[model samples]
Target: METSRKPVLYSYFRSSCSWRVRIALALKGVAYDQAPVNLVKDGGQQLSSEFQSVNPMQQVPALKIDGITLSQSLAIIEYLEETRPDPRILPQDPKKRAQVRMISDHIASGIQPLQNLAVLQQMGEKKMEWAQRCISRGFKALEQTLQETAGRYCVGDEVSMADLCLVPQVYNAERYKVDLAPYPTIRRINKALLELEEFKTSHPSRQPDTPPELKA
Candidate 1:
């Protein structure tokens, strides 16, 4: 049960940032070890000193690989993109790559940060309403962005980092009761992405740490 050949990933089933990295690793055919950090237990395992040593930010997706630890979902992904160039996650064209990053940033920074667990926990009773409004506004902008940049996937027919980022945000939106009916392009792309083996396997429901009651 103990093997160090594969890189170790510190993750949580429901953390969308962790989900992004999971999807990327599966898509690239990289073998990794999953070390689940239960975010809701003991007020959050991520906040513990042990995990903080791995990621000062105490985030769920702290990857330990290449003899070092890396944190921040996007940064860990970019490192993978750089080191493992085959089956690329980014496009060859500079403009297209920029477009992909633009949409990715829109979700990662614009939407995700606003509705994260800490923020929602702070909002308490108002969290549901606040998160719904935040998701609606962000999705409105994202739908417009996708209308221009998407073609089957967020950037083009090929799956990019944008699509990886998109699916989990949409999942989070659903959790907050944010309707997806208005975002036709997002829904279309998400449906297609869900069908992929990589995306399907990387879903929260399929993760090892998913509770028996929650697993698909």
Candidate 2:
């Protein structure tokens, strides 16, 4: 069924939201073509009118599948899961599904939204130290929660949506020079996820959109 259709992902290299969708797609063993939207250069290609037609919000990580264009990383991920369920990114049990959703939301809602590149750029341009401080504060709370919930992965031994959320957030924290030593659970889980082929392959460095200077 999937072989007949082409799935094109419109994504940015450094956008953590795009990273999430990339990791989810890789885990599900889904094949897709990537259309890179360089976020840093030329004032962000995402803001262009051409990209805006695909996603009115002008956000990275929009998915075009079977002639349908969709925005929002989580929404796109859910759509992929519903349409292709072979390698389930979500748990089948109701309780486990809720747990995964809760973990994804904690980072998606509580952390990533505030610390996004655009938000941080605004803080820097405005010389707002308080915004940066708030990110650190949020990380501390997340670290504590991760410690309580982690066991091989964020929610359990199974690699669910939580692990997907954790890896990118950890990467962002490291980029910000945030002290990750305080979050041992996050550190451990992230390390484990990195060792896996799916997580490693979908990393920003591996993305075609990633700049040559940043690739390692």
Candidate 3:
């Protein structure tokens, strides 16, 4: 919990889920080591024996701290919140917190799970058009919701967990070649989020695993 030691994060540069955790860690001012797990190289380095020991699920964005390891970005973020409350990302009011969580879930549950790289790969093996259609549909719903709730940030002026969720999903949508112009809300929030130092630094292009050409 203390900032004295650095936490180890198993992450990939291009992974939106890992980028979410990276952004949260940076926002919390939590020092961490970027243990790059090249998702595309070496037949998916996350599945390697060495990495699997850290995460049996062989997933990127795992965390190791004080001999305790954790899986899943959202869960890891909640742990960080519980252990370190300063500069809180969630709202103090229960209703506001629920709203924040709702927006986070809108992306986490509603969109991310469907368009994850692995899932998209599986879909590609079946049909690429189907993959694009599903991702577009999810984005359409997200665009509508963000238009209704967005202010300076996703839910308001303060950077809640929702902003963290929104930024990376937008990046993923772009990667899938999804036209973002239709989602004016998403484009607006994405522009604002990109201006922040934390979000800018935690961007996938800024990570070590990101290709030189992709770096912004």
C-alpha root-mean-square deviation, each candidate: 2.4, 1.9, 1.8
Sort by lDDT, top down from the best? 1, 3, 2
Question: Per-residue CA lDDT of candidate 3, range 120-169, in tens?
Answer: 67775654565567668877887777676778887777888888888998
What 10-residue stretch in candidate 1 is worst by lDDT?
A: 1-10
Error of 3 at 68 (Å): 1.2
Q: Which candidate tops lDDT?
A: 1
Clashing pairs in 1: none
Candidate 1 error regions (>4 Å)? 1-4
Reference-based TM-score, model 3: 0.92
lDDT of each: 0.92, 0.81, 0.82
lDDT of 2 by residue, 5-61 (tens): 778899987788888899888988888999998877788888999988888998888
The better candidate by lDDT, 1 or 3, is: 1
Cα displacement (angstroms), candidate 1, residue 183, comes to 0.5
Instruction: Give lDDT: candidate 3, residue 213.
Output: 100
lDDT of 3 at 23: 85
Question: Which candidate has the highest TM-score of all?
Answer: 1
